[model samples]
Target chain A: DTAVSQTPKYLVTQMGNDKSIKCEQNLGHDTMYWYKQDSKKFLKIMFSYNNKELIINETVPNRFSPKSPDKAHLNLHINSLELGDSAVYFCASSPKIVGVQYFGPGTRLTVT
Target chain B: AQSVTQPDIHITVSEGASLELRCNYSYGATPYLFWYVQSPGQGLQLLLKYFSGDTLVQGIKGFEAEFKRSQSSFNLRKPSVHWSDAAEYFCAVGARLNRDDKIIFGKGTRLHILP
Candidate 1:
């Protein structure tokens, strides 16, 4: 079984369009996180949810919002996407707040 | 603030050659360290981690890392390099706040293997 999975592996949308990326993990973890990797391969943490509660919100823009319906699922929604939003988004889950994180295959989003 | 730094952006090593990737962190207290490898068009995979005991920690794919408190460095090393090892390496630092956890990842170092 796939430990972690993300839907719509590749997303290509026009500027000003809104899109959402869904992530699900079957590792039965309590902590889930979202990360963005820019073209330069610089990975930065965006948000983290522990048991469906927001724990860390790194200086992400308001347009980007993360919603966790349950501990197993965390989805990212971006509004009025801009060119800068074109990057690979990854979802990770850890058993504990500071445990080893298991990452999904990643979703590549392109805003043109 | 906690931050991880990888000085070398890229490194090339011949096959069967010993390899080492440098990683440094800036934190007030002892921090949780990790080394992850990411192949092209793939997600990051944890190679090894250091929490407390044993400065030298072994990981999958014949990779190991040593944590040095004096220098705040956790460098990953391998006895021999394989072409499959050609990928991007990331060093990360995890810190526990009062009621939260924060993880910072370095920009990453790309590894290239030569025949």
Candidate 2:
């Protein structure tokens, strides 16, 4: 079984259009995270949720919001998306705070 | 703030050649460290990690890393390089972020295998 999965592996949308990326993990991990890889391939932590509680929110723009309905699912919603939003978004889950993280196949977002 | 650094942006090696990727981190305490690999159009995969105990940690795909506390480095080394191993390798440091912990990643080192 796929330990981690994400929906709409590739997303192409126009600027100003809102979109959402869904992530789910069957590993039963309590911590989930959202990371963004920019054009330069620099990976940065965007948001993190531990047991459905907002734990870490990096200096991400207000347009980006993460919603975790349960410990298994965490979705990212980008509003008023801009061209800079074009990047690969990855979702990861780990059982402990400092354990190895299992990552899902990222969703590549392209804002035209 | 804890951070990671991968000095080599790109590395190329012939098949069967030994490989070593450098990773350095800046943290006061003994930090949780990890090495991850990402292929084209794929998510990151954990190769290995070092939390404590033995400084030399073994990982899958015949890869291992040695944690040198004095150097603040956890470098990944492989006995032989395969074409399948060509990918972007990332080094990360686990640190506190607000109320929770966060894994800070370096820019990544792209590995190229030559036949």
Candidate 3:
């Protein structure tokens, strides 16, 4: 069983289009996060939701929005996707203690 | 502000040889350290973590790391390198304010395996 799962393992779209990535965790974790991995393999946290409440919001562009339907699900919606947005988007979850984060198979987005 | 640094951008090691990856962090308190490995086209997998107690922590894939508070460093080491171990390794630190605080990741180090 996958502890953390994400949809759309790969996404290819034209610039200026909007897309969304969904993530879920079955480990009963209360905290979910969104991270972006650029071509240089730098993983940076974009946003975090704790118990369905927005907690940490990095200096990411406003086009990226995170929505948490419940504690187990967090979805990221990006508007007016730019060429720079073509990166691997990863979703992760952690217990309240924030020990080791469980990551899902990243979604590789390509902007044309 | 807290941050993690992985000095070596890339490292190469022959198969069966020992490997070491250095990591340093800047934080005000006793920081929580972690090591994660990411294979090509895959997400990051936790290799090990150091919360407290023993300064040494063992992890999967025959990897281990030592937390040196005085040095403000947590270096990962493996007795022998495997070809499959050639991937990107990241060092992360957890925020101490909130247990669920976000994790700050380093730029990551790419390991090259020489067979």
lDDT digits (tens) for residues B63-103 of candidate 3: 99999989999999999999999999999998668644667
- Cand. 3 TM to true fold: 0.97
- The 10 consecutive residues of candidate 2 chain B with the worst lDDT sum are B95-104
For model 3, how does the per-residue alpha-carbon lDDT over A4-81 read when each residue is reduced to its tens digit? 999999999999999999999999998899999998998888988889998889899999999999999999999999
Pairs that collide in candidate 3 are none
lDDT (10s digit) by residue, model 2, range A1-112: 9999999899999999999999999998999999999988899889989899998899999999999999999999999999989999999999977578999999999999
Instruction: Please give me the total number of clashing residue pairs in predicted model 1.
Output: 0
- For candidate 1, lDDT tens digit of each residue in A73-111? 999999999999999999999998877999999999999
**Predicted complexes: DockQ each:** 0.81, 0.77, 0.68
TM-score of each: 0.98, 0.97, 0.97
Best-to-worst order by TM-score is 1, 2, 3
- Tens digits of per-residue lDDT, candidate 2, B1-115, equal 7989999999999999999999999998889999999998899999999988999999989999999999999999999989999999999998643456688899999999999
Consecutive 10-residue window with the lowest summed lDDT within model 1 chain A: A94-103
Which one wins on DockQ? 1
Fnat of all models, as shown:
0.73, 0.84, 0.68
